[model samples]
Target: MNDQGEELLARVRAVLSDAGFDETATGAEGVHLIRHARGVMLGWLPEDLAQPRRRGPRRSRRPAPADLPGLRRAFGLAMAAALRAAGLTVETRGDEWLLVAFERAADAS
Candidate 1:
């Protein structure tokens, strides 16, 4: 990775770590690696729970399995916002992996 790529990777690591996700699962090797070419591909595991959750008004901190999708969406948006705030024109997308493409300044014209 180049200098820019390294900087971006650090930024992403900080973002995800602050949001309760780690690049590596507990007691294991790194969970994912960042790949950058035209864009950056960041892979991280979603929620860990496997069982369905009960319908209720009150619950613990953990989200229901069904809520994983929404949770991921929130995380993605948060990441994108952070990147934008850093003054990098960016387009973010993902399923279980996040793909962040920086809109090069020269290409913005």
Candidate 2:
């Protein structure tokens, strides 16, 4: 990889780490963060009026038990948002990963 590629990867890794993903033991494979679907929900009423109760304020985002796919999807959504929030340009590469890079001006030579 060239210096620019290295720099971009480093920046993406840092942002992912800051957003709570654990670096994969393989390192270069990728990073991942998992949060339960429950944690991502807005505490909305689910189902056909099962156990009814008023909505409660969720003070903080926390993890809980959920399916692997669900967790991955949620993580991807959040990770993408964080990267954009950090001011990087992002493009989805299927559902598995994102292509992130520093934003460039269209007029750049």
Candidate 3:
């Protein structure tokens, strides 16, 4: 990536951080790997529960299976908002969730 790309990347990352998300991993060379820090609340109990969660478990805080979809959706929405705010273009390649941004030839100084 060029200097412009790196700078834009930093700005985008800052936006995500400011939006209550954290960079969890270094995904592909150009993609940002981010997730919500507190995670999406399922309005119910976490996994590792013995029953249907009347009061809930006073034990581990492992996320329930149902929470995965909500988490993924939250991440996607945040990413979309950040990209839109940045005026960045995202290309969906097959089944991969990826976001790529750059200065087009005409937009470059």
Candidate 4:
């Protein structure tokens, strides 16, 4: 990997760690950060029916079970996002990962 690619991967690992994912659990293949979204709702009920209820949203984002495919997908997305943040372009070619970043060519002087 080029320097930029390596740097980008490091940043991605850091982000994953900050997001509560295990950095050591990651590899060139990828990492996963299983997370869920929750929300609470409050409402008034009809008399003699029920009191105000706190309900959670029916739709929530849940993490997939720890699996190879799940980890790959999560890792790929995280790495891609990190690369973008670093102004690099990432391309996944079949089983190969490619990262392109601008670098100043060596000066002949």
Candidate 5:
């Protein structure tokens, strides 16, 4: 991973944590979601899940699950909007439940 990727993951972790998600592990291929204080409502997509990957011949090169395109796009847009609403910029890569979001500083006028 590059520096930018590391930074992006950090930002995602921070945002999710603030939104009530717990940090369970720092592993590369783990998915995490937020649990509300009362546990009534779980965190929504994009922020709740990491990019979904299927087991492949080689663990390093797995394929993304099907049925993720639309969901990923919608989740990405929602996350982006949420980040923007918090005065941050978001960029996503990949499709539905597999999208990853990175927070960035808004452009200075």
Candidate 6:
């Protein structure tokens, strides 16, 4: 990851963390997951895909989405907006687990 990548990831971490996903969880295949609810998992996945796990109990389900669609769209939008506001071009890839890339205009030249 480059400096921009690091910054982007940091921003993501902050956004998610502030949204109450402070629990650190590990997913399958060395993937990182932030557990927010009973079956909600969030992360910057490889294929940009992610699914929920039936974790015993949920702490606070406030502002929880009904399904993956809600999670994806809402969180994805937040990430895109944050990245774009930071002057980085946000590229989104995948569905089940969304993959996001941050790029600068100069880097494209």
Best by lDDT: 1
Cα TM-score per model: 0.52, 0.54, 0.48, 0.31, 0.36, 0.39
| Candidate 4 structure lDDT | 0.40
- How far off is residue 90 in model 2, in Å? 1.2
True-structure lDDT of candidate 6: 0.47
Question: Candidate 2 residues 1-109, lDDT tens each?
Answer: 5566556667777877797753564323346322222111111111222233447864323222242346556667787898788887766655555667444658956
Each model's backbone clash number: 0, 0, 0, 0, 3, 8
Per TM-score, the best of the predicted structures is: 2
Steric clash pairs (candidate 2): none
lDDT of all predictions, in order shown?
A: 0.59, 0.52, 0.47, 0.40, 0.46, 0.47
For candidate 5, write residues 1-109 as lDDT tens digits. Answer: 5566555556666766675444454333334433222111112333335435667653523335553557655545655565456555443434433234444458999
- Flag regions of model 4 displaced more than 4 Å: 1-67, 95-98, 101-109
Off by over 4 Å in 5: 1-14, 18-24, 28-63, 94-109
Candidate 4's TM-score reads 0.31
Tell me the spans in candidate 2 whose CA falls farther than 4 Å from its real position: 27-68, 105-109
**Of models 5 and 6, which has the larger lDDT?**
6
Candidate 3 lDDT over 1-109, as tens digits, reads 5566556667666766776654543332223443222211111122323333447557445554454666555556556676667666654422325454454568556
Error of 3 at 108 (Å): 11
At residue 15, what lDDT does model 3 achieve? 66
Worst 10 residues of 1 by lDDT: 25-34
Residue 90 shift from truth in candidate 3, angstroms: 2.6
Model 1 Cα lDDT, one tens digit per residue, 1-109: 7777877777766765665556774544323546668556755445454546669775664554356777666665665566566554455454555566645656554
* 2 against 6, candidate with superior lDDT: 2
Each candidate's root-mean-square deviation in Å? 6.9, 12.5, 9.5, 15.9, 11.2, 10.4
Error of 1 at 68 (Å): 3.8
